[model samples]
Target chain A: MSSCGVLVVAGTHGNEVNAPWLLQQWQANPDLIDAAGLAVQKVIGNPEALRRRCRYVDRDLNRCFLPEQLEQGASGLEFQRAGELLRLHGPSGEQPCAVAIDLHSTTAAMGNSLVVYGRRPADLALAALVQGALGLPIYLHEADAQQTGFLVESWPCGLVIEVGPVPQGLLNAGVVEQTRLGLESCLRALYQVRQELARLPDALVVHRHLGSRDLPKAENGEPQALVHPELQGRDWQNIASTQAMFRAADGTDRCEAWVGGEIPVFVNEAAYAEKSIAFSLTRREVWPVEPNWLLALKQLLAAA
Target chain B: MSSCGVLVVAGTHGNEVNAPWLLQQWQANPDLIDAAGLAVQKVIGNPEALRRRCRYVDRDLNRCFLPEQLEQGASGLEFQRAGELLRLHGPSGEQPCAVAIDLHSTTAAMGNSLVVYGRRPADLALAALVQGALGLPIYLHEADAQQTGFLVESWPCGLVIEVGPVPQGLLNAGVVEQTRLGLESCLRALYQVRQELARLPDALVVHRHLGSRDLPKAENGEPQALVHPELQGRDWQNIASTQAMFRAADGTDRCEAWVGGEIPVFVNEAAYAEKSIAFSLTRREVWPVEPNWLLALKQLLAAA
Candidate 1:
């Protein structure tokens, strides 16, 4: 008997059914998992709300996770159930290792992709495998102080597979299919980890976190178009601006691009807002703060 | 004579500080103007930076009118001048029944308190009565953006006074006495009917722009956090565990909080590192936007 690995699937908000449905389909198709030579457990998160096809019943299921709540044995019905299932089915003794994957969708109009945890070599190897197998861009995020309470942060080698938008009551068939393929790709990547995975892309360390900014505004008070810096090499596209650029900072009314160049990359969610437009990607060269600096600062201040 | 109702002042830069010091001290003396009841010109702005003691030269004399820049600019030369002078001069233009008080301090923190312009109601009022006032705040800053290459957002009712903090000097005893007595207490408020100033604060509006979060370690060694919520005010504060928050739609950490609350009040700056601490300020009632909304969303996405 092979030691089985664990797969974490969530974001079952009715408005976000693609992820759960995709996971269910993948679980039903044993060939997909069998081809990759891995065992899988499918946990349905947010069942009540997912049944209702709504974002949430009371509070957002996503935000209900907190450390105190976990310690006190507090959990939203869905989270509690999911946690219980994982604990009950700890990794199969036969499997030397296990991995989890969380599926999700974005509001922004973007290509199918995945976001991996910061520069952990294991995670990078996994990301490269998935990227190569699934043929999608992989965004790496280095976590920091201000960000807290995430499921992947507490799991080992978790991958957040982001499909495109899933409107209410409408399941994006393309997204569902792509998600299935992506999951299979993950299993394949994990299966090959013992051998070729070591040759995957070296995990690029992101030391200092430069902030994000929104794109410039047009003259008519509309959001200017934006393009992600990473997509530069890819044949990515963007919508056109409807109005001229207006300077919100000093009220300097002028055209959007004072100097002609490619639009800056959009970072974070709410890509439409001005603040999310991050122009420069400040790495260690510009800002040398360690990943733990902000956490340390907050702790020091809290102690003081 | 029509009593001088408004005063206009400008040019209190450290390089040109002769006017501000003289005016500040002059405005302080009660006996300078005729005893006959009439509106009097008051000492205007920036005695400290104009005194040219420290950190003044590097600061730009303009750009202080911006609300965000005002607080950060406080220690800078431009901030002191704007705060000190704009209070006295009011806005530009001479009203039939108004007087302008423009006061200034110089780089030397020396020089006579001179009333440079008095054409408008505010200006004429200061000229008529405050010419030889004891020690007064100098007011000057009437140069146009295009013409004078200075930032004098205030218009019509204007005054230009220059005093000390020039040629490497300290605030003279006379100027200090005048500023304390002439401008500090007496000029409690200044108003303009023509142009609308951004509303002042009856209560502090706390604006918290978002940033990244701390990644948490989970049992599976996978990083986890909450997914960023699309709705406003859904972001939480003081998230202890990094395992619960979600990466944002754009691949950054997520964050959230009430539009105006203790959190925004606590963190004041908007810019933050990708995985670092960041903040901003805004009116309590204002809808989430900018530096605040974008940042808050980023933090929520990263930490959610």
Candidate 2:
């Protein structure tokens, strides 16, 4: 078998410091990896950014992973870093990463969520196993032109472990500890799949991603409104059409509310503020696990 | 009397968005002041940084207000901005500000507190009034060479209205609303002192600044540990000698415990992590307000 294993990536956004800190701890104590002998490789996605205690040196590293962006090979900090990461750990690389798990924390109140870029069978299987065990709400993000080039898309089987309510560049013990538990669930899923003991639940819960909306901006693009006080920190919850979503600094309702039957995600994400995305909406669903998902996961794990 | 008033400064760190957002709200609706006609000059301390959604461009704008730093303002974004602010609102400037109330927020669980540079009677009187009315804790910062050059120090009388448990660049409704109340308290104190209707409590509660300690770091200055889980959000509370103040990523305790009786402030403050200050220690005290404190406040408010 080729040198393949589960790859755990942290520091994708350098300012999200908790997971990186946990990675270091896991390094010092190999026992923390209770994955039943699965080869787990941990790496910091943006070492330079982590050193500076900021999100990125030039551009967002997570967003720099698209094929077109990588093909250009222009000299930018995150651009170069992305090429280097793929060169070392891409599917065709010498030390191939079978399944990559990108760890992230957000200012949004998204408590231990999994983000699958598309409904890829392998990605779904992994997310399903973790969600089955941990009851994590999987955010199926797809068809968003503005938000493409996610890190997990490069790997044959990968998903994002997004934890939060933790601030950037600040460590919250509960967020860190809770995130570790979620990661452990991922590892256990991987180990079980390798041993053919994997049992993903019949139904996989997902929050189907809808397009996001930016905070209302003025002529100069300065935000005229922020996420309304009422909707702030109310991520993953269903909202009525009448619910206030955006309020001007003067406390005036300046933007349209979310349509009823849609759940809000990434509400007031600190990083998304720069991207102008106040929040993304989603529709919750419980879909039966497809047989192709388990087959893909088995094939991926068998490779490792 | 000079052209004096309470200069309410926000966006001093830029990433502290709630206060600036509130300041903008207050500007649009002047009725929020409720200060009985106390002139409150609201301004974004670092407008450029606010636009970038970061802290500062060159140096920390809040730390660029020293006598020497201002004199040598050959050129830098914040350096020039500091000179400009002084030219506009300095004691000797066109719009002489009597009491400058700097607004700030932290990632730490500091709640609503007051930070006085040193024990100036004017500062104490203001703190006393607010503390008496609101029961807010005061952090008396002094004699720390490591932390010099503050925006409030530029004015003859000023204090920072530091609020928190809020993350940087993320606005929490509770934090934003509560902070506005704190600013109102400051404005009301000025108005009360001006009309000679101020009656500060007999005792003024203070957390006397002692010193700060950083998280255990590796040789290259990368932190080896974060604020321990137990002590993570216990700001302004006494820490025991045996308390685990810091723990390595792997959940290993690796830092010295606090020496008991010393209260911690700015616990895991995101901004202070760069300055190597995980948390600053303070000794809690309840001191009787001196008669001169009210007199000093009267003079400052009367001038405004």
Using DockQ, give the best candidate's number: 2
Question: Residue A159 CA error for candidate 2 (Å)?
Answer: 0.3
Candidate 2 off by > 4 Å: A72-75, A239-242, A248-258, B32-35, B68-80, B238-242, B254-257
lDDT of each: 0.39, 0.84
Tell me which residue pairs clash in candidate 2: A25-B250
Tens digits of per-residue lDDT, candidate 2, A213-249, equal 8877768775767778789878888787888777764
- Per-residue lDDT tens digits for candidate 1, residues B1-304, read 2233434342334423323434432444455333233344433244455443222354545445554555465665566565555444433323321333344443222244332331233333222223323333222223223223133335333333333321222222333344333332222222211112112222211222232232232465323322222221222232333322333212345443333332221121111111132222222222222233223222222221
lDDT of 1: 0.39
User: Can you write out model 1's per-residue Cα lDDT over A212-290, one digit (the tens) per residue?
Assistant: 4444544664333333222321212232343233222212233443222222222223212322332323232112223
DockQ score of each predicted structure, in the order shown:
0.01, 0.50
